[model samples]
Target chain A: MTIVDPIIFNAFLNESKEAVESLEADLVKLESDLENKNLINSVFRSLHTIKGNASFLDLDNITTVAHEAETLLDEVRSGKRKINQTSIDLVYSVVDVLQEMLEDPEMAQAIKSVNVLKVEESKIEHIVSLVHELELLRYSMEKLPAQLEGERGDISEGLFNLELATSKASRITSELGAIVFGARLVPVNNVFRRFPRIVRELAKKLDKKIELKVLNGSAKLDKSIVEAIADPMTHLIRNAVDHGVESPENRQAKGKKQQGTITLNSFVDGNLVVIEIKDDGKGMDPDLILYQAAEKGIIFRGKENTMSDSEKLGLIFAPGFSTAEQVTDISGRGVGMDVVKSNINKLKGMVQIESTLGIGTTIQLRFPFSVVVASCLYVYIDEVCYAIPLSQMEESIHIAKGELFTQSPQRLKSGEEAMAVYSLQELLTGKFQIKQGIKELPAVRVRRKDGRLIALIVDEFSIMEEAVIHSVDSYISSIPGIQGGVIRRDGLVSIALSIDSLLETTFKKIPLAYAVNKERKHPEITDLQKLIEDAREITDGVLDFKLS
Target chain B: MRIYRRELFIFDIGGVPLALRMEDVEYILPASEITSVPKTAQFVLGLAAVRGKIMSVIDGGLRLRIQRQGTSYFVVCHVRGNTTAVLINRPLEAKNLSVKKIESSDVERILARHKLNPKMFSAAWEILKKKDSHWSETGRKFLEINTDQFVSDQMASKIIVG
Candidate 1:
């Protein structure tokens, strides 16, 4: 057989997987309505397609399984074999095998500790014996009395039926969702379970004693997010063993335990799923990082004393920045952290690092619970559409033009405190857009992680929509405020805004005038007018400087 | 690692001819609507959906500090490990030519005369086997663009903010 191009093989695999999922659902429905011609035809067509596609790729295992299933379905379709519990069960087993093959192509290890032929033969034998047992059970049930002696058993029938029906409906609903949208909530254990062996091997190789502890492994994330996050998690784990942890001798000398501990914890916080990797090793030295970062030109040399410990530790994420004095085979070539940060960013997430000089370091990655589909408020700025994730938005309010309590720094007085209001256009373009004679402007208020409120004034607000967000290329998402891209049903691509990034990059640089204006209130009309004029002058000067 | 001839995808920016490695060019498409991105360099025309993939559209003339005429096509190519579409007047053709690497010091005077920066180019390649006399008679030397440096945010900011 000719070697297949990996791209084509992957495409075929994805298509076949979806077909198999739909086929499984259809087969399940067919079991209840055995005489449903449409369901039978659909199942037959799916099996035929899978068989043909598998044969084309020379995936002989998949071809053999699918062909056998197709033959059985053909027998039922032709009335040669009657549809029964045994036949349905047989087909179910076949679907399971096909799904297994699709997931692990080439049968590398799908059937653990056995060759493909032996596994296939044994699987068939097991299925036949199971079918025999099922028939025996059915016969035994039929031989029982029609009515039970206990009154509780009579009531239990209704309750049992309800529970069974409810579970079946839920399963069908979930399977339909998987088939239609191709998004499922999968446990983080899918990615976490692969780390124990990796950590063990790496620690042995580095001549260190490290123990990895995974907590809350059942925390769920979108399937795609789990898959995309695997590499970054791997890199972080390796970095922990290579850089975060010290040698056993060094740990003993420091009055610490010889076995270092790396804890991987995951939990869902409201709408966000956060994963934290904490290592109890010789913790990161912020001063050392500061010195190295300045020497490498990653940060200003003299500004080290002014930065906090967390801020100093953030320099490790700068591209090509490393504090290691010597190169190692595992890491310190200075590429891992930045790549991890960027990968997390691409997943519409953020990475936060915290460390103590003597204690360990903790790196936390937070992501939206569901990255595939999100409720976003569609807003138009400069005639282009942008989607702001509703999770990040505190509230949307209409600000009457005349209701501004202060104009110097654009504040909207909510209740007790005034929130800084900025034009979304200005924040995005870095230029002041003067829109004259507008009655009321649409604004969205978002709170920072520090609980500071900032309102963004947009050109116009559209309806809140549940949009499907797709990650853009890193080149485009690398821009400060753009988190991802969403293509509308009408084929318009709208950039998704990352509120955190926008706050960090643009809103944080709103000048010292905001503080001054916030402290002093201009209650008189004359003072308000003068403040407005001053604000315009300052805005014009800033725009001039930016546009120059 | 050495080859006799390098394949180049030649295109026109502002009547000044330029070439990129043929492998770098993904495909060429007729000019389509490009959405302008805010808070980006002026040369970044913005994003465009090319066959369902988001690509950053770059204005070649603005990036290279040249005056380009009407654009006829957008050359979708890989720039700094990202898919980017560079606007050009036209894509001439792909040609294989024997090229000799010219030192930056040797081309400093020529590049300075043309108001071009040496850092914007990966290396200046003297076309040793020029089939057409137009470039030779005009004394126009072939230079390969360093996409990594040319499309960088810092480089764009410096060129525009200056």
Candidate 2:
């Protein structure tokens, strides 16, 4: 058979798969109401479409099975055959065969073989033998009734025990059903298995001896998350080999082993999957990154002087910013890092970089293991429900209304550290009015990724529960302080708050003094305000002093 | 000779009737709980889940320079591979309108009179003048908005407040 264009073929394959999935779901529903003509017609159409497409592509195996399935569905549609338990079983078997055909289309050629289809002669024989064995087991269980009669002869007790067992079995079956229908967990090795080959080839081409180690390869995560992270993870690994690991001669001169080591370590941390990539080679130079960013016009000239070392390191993620002296085919195109950042951000994940000038560089990528299910603490502000991810939450404290405005500077003191307090209502809806006659306000203390804590004052704290998180559109996700939307148990959509984004915005709004002296017991708020004005005047409002 | 009739989905936003090409509309849904997004343009009401997909909901009134008000329905429009919900005050009505193409001079006149950005509109459908009616002018037309361009403009105009 002539092969179709791969793009067209792939599209056909995806569409066919979706159709089959929908057909299966509809079939399950049809088991309850088999006389529903609409569903029967829908199922028939799906099979007919598949058969036609397969024939158009000249795939005889798939076309044959789909044709047979369509014929069987036609009988039911025409009311020639009544729907029954046996017919439902037969339809399920057809679905199984279709699923197998999807996996390997050539398998459809074995339709004539009873053992191959597993639904013909051999299947009946197997069922008959199982039934014979079950009869014997039932005969043995008949002694239990006699034993019960000899012991107490209480029929009510026996019935109660049976009822208890039935209830337990029902609960277990429901739990199993939930696990089967909910989000799937896939092994991390699905993405990691391709790395060793990549590292080997890149190391050979670069003429550097390198060792790649993968830890926790058996860790499983949601399939969608795993697929999303595959490309970004590959990009990070390539960067590790191309830009991070130095030449063997240079490594030796730097008092490092000739064979450099790159380790990919992943582990579950609470609700997050932390993947760390560490390379024992020449680390990055912060000053070089800053200079390169300036040269590329990614950052303003002289602005590099104001950036901290860590902030300078972050410039590598800027678009078209590269520290490499020359461009190569593998990397240094100044395109890969920004894409890595954006792709990870699309997964609602965060990436952080830590490096020592000469020791090594460790890049950490953190993602929520299951993007669908997350533990969220719901809080109500101005009668609006907002959910905060439990992973980012620190604790909730009730603050008296009088203490909120009684301090010289409006700040929340937790231990010896003071943080600038902001109202959640004001930040979200742009409404600054607190509820009238409210005495004690509930404040949620949230910690940023950088370990900075901020107290978000709200009206009250609601219940905490595990919820399925639904992501918002890209346009809305781009807005600061709004992460996504989560449908609560009450069927209402609540805004999932990104505490990190909120704190970043809050930190930017506060004066530099309060931000820098957050650890101090008391920083003169008046002096801080004056300093901010002076700094603003000197910079002519062109400079923004921010924490890295 | 063949006559061509263009079908449009017409709805009212802030009391002004507007029409959009039927092909661009995915489906109309009842406006539900919209999660308010911060640091966005005033026209962006927030995000809403429509048919299991989260879409950014834009207030059609604010986009057309009308007073801001709550909308009861959302018109889901798919443009440039992005799905967005345009808030409307009432149910959308599908009408097959027999329209004539407007001349360039008339287009310019309409643009100048409404003070509308030239890029925001793509085509104009001329409605035949009817006697003893609200629109009795000879050159009455309803401008067709370029949804792709309008969405991009709204997103670009978002104020990034810290």
Candidate 3:
């Protein structure tokens, strides 16, 4: 409703986690007392409650696995089958997958898809199969006829339970998925090893096997980032597998290997950690993309329809721009290429494609390893002061009143013909009341896009120490000009302002509030401003010199 | 529960000065100790380290826009519940003010002379306002600090932080 406030949601999620953990502990104890149907019922009830809570949160994937796990546990509780390892392990794996999926990459999509119900289906089947297998074995052992028996029936039942228990143990192991989740993981050389099994399974399903490879992984990505990159990487690889790699028959026909190959490589370079997904398959056809763009009305078909290949290729990032007519239900409609691009951008990274018609495609992605620390720049505009990241800043310059040229309502050109100036008032709405007699045009310019191309004009700029950033919940997340508020050195809160956003807010709203002598406001020493009148009177004879 | 206020420091503002309760002040450092934080609001002094942790030091005088005649000491006060710091000129003394009920009118009048918005003044300002003014509604002869606002929650309530 309100982006489901994370604080309360976090608390709720924590409670559910506790409930699941307690159930786990109880189930472990129940493992020994197979005939204790009462214990089985109690465990079933707890899992049922946890599943209900997850469903209420619309975490259906979790709900499904949990529901299935609960169903089989219900059978055990109903005395249809004795409690054993298979059932317990199924429940454990369900819980593990639920936890892992809670932080899964495909979660956002799954939340919207009907197939979200499918995640629990397999897990449920796994548990049911275990229960069914154990029941059959136990029933068969009991049916064993005469003499030769000895304690064979009992031993056979014990064997069935043990097999069931093995599965249960592994399911519990799957919960260790938590260990590799989101931010919790510290990947090593071995981390790359885990991907092959997944790739192989997926390849087998697609009826193709690619020699998947993992390159240098000496650098460890905080689990969350790794998780963040997972889906984007998956989409890219899937595209490479389906569209990039040719089938074995085709590959052989083309004088290439019958077994197509795709390589997944990752390493750290400069300030960025690079992840490149390359495949030796047919590359994307730029001409086809241009034709699709024209057909979709993304770009007008004009006399210049004979556009450069690069211009045509850029169409891949246009919204709703798709090259495929029928959705393959695979790596997007070639539609979400824009999404992949933008998502990587959100990570403060860039993605580029290097592909030729028959040659393989290489998608190179580079991201700032970790913005763990940022140099903050503090600026004051009228009464409101805010912080800017020095990481994005280039320089600050002072301008005289006459320096600003008003070309249009929302635009101010500062002698440099191209620079756009944003007034402080427009930056943060209702932040300060600019009235009579404030002097001096105090402004700072921050470099944007590239240092050479654009500059953002702001109220002021200077650098400060780095601190752990705490952002406000979404209720007040997008305050005009404010990116997030941070605790300052003096224990007073200073807002972290988005210079670009602030500028945009200014331009979008007024677009035409032309300034008159924009820089004439010099530092006015008023004897009576509400915030400082008392100190002024007491120090009537004192001289206040400015700090440089 | 006993609320231990941090160590207090004394400083002057104008010719008349006051002390800030130590619990509020995070650190006291030389003027030279302050570093420049770019693009910050004017009141911010810069960054400084107290004990081992680095913190932002604000110019309380600049924060309140308090004026003074000479070189001043920096008192970094932690904003309630937030890590932000507010810098103030040195406090003159640290004296505990007991809670008392008084008319808000008295505060308004007292602050009028200093050109302070009576809204921001402490109970101390109210007492001075009543004594200096002719208003009889200000009630009680002496002034009391709204303890909850002035100091800590262990005492009484009604002090507001905005």
Candidate closest to the true structure, highest DockQ? 2
How accurate is chain B of model 1, given as a TM-score from 0 to 1? 0.75
lDDT by residue (A112-193, candidate 2, tens digit) is 2222111235435544654565565456455547545656557676555544443333333333332432336555666675
Candidate 1, residue A30: CA error in Å?
41
- Ordered from best to worst TM-score, the candidate numbers read 2, 1, 3
Per lDDT, the best of the predicted structures is 1
Query: Candidate 3: global Cα-lDDT?
Result: 0.52
lDDT digits (tens) for residues A1-548 of candidate 3 = 22444544454454565556556545655655667767677767767877887777776667788788888887776668666778776776776676576556554433342210112354455446656756665565454432134344465666555544443433333322212221232343323443443455456666775777665554445545655766667667767776787777777788988777777776433234467788888777888887778887888888236677666776787888865545676655756778888887776678878778877888887664322223576776544556665544555555544444344423433543344444554345433233333333455555443342233334455456543233322212233444444445343455555565455444344321123233343233322233223333443233222111
Arrange candidates by DockQ, descending: 2, 1, 3
Worst 10 residues of 1 chain A by lDDT: A110-119
Residue B81, model 2: lDDT of 54
Q: lDDT value for candidate 2?
A: 0.66
For residue A218, what is the lDDT in candidate 1?
Answer: 64
TM-score of each: 0.49, 0.50, 0.31
Candidate 3 local Cα displacement, residue A134, angstroms: 59
**Residue clash pairs of candidate 2:** none
Query: Could you give the CAPRI-style class of model 2?
Result: incorrect
Tell how far residue A182 is off in model 2, in angstroms.
5.6
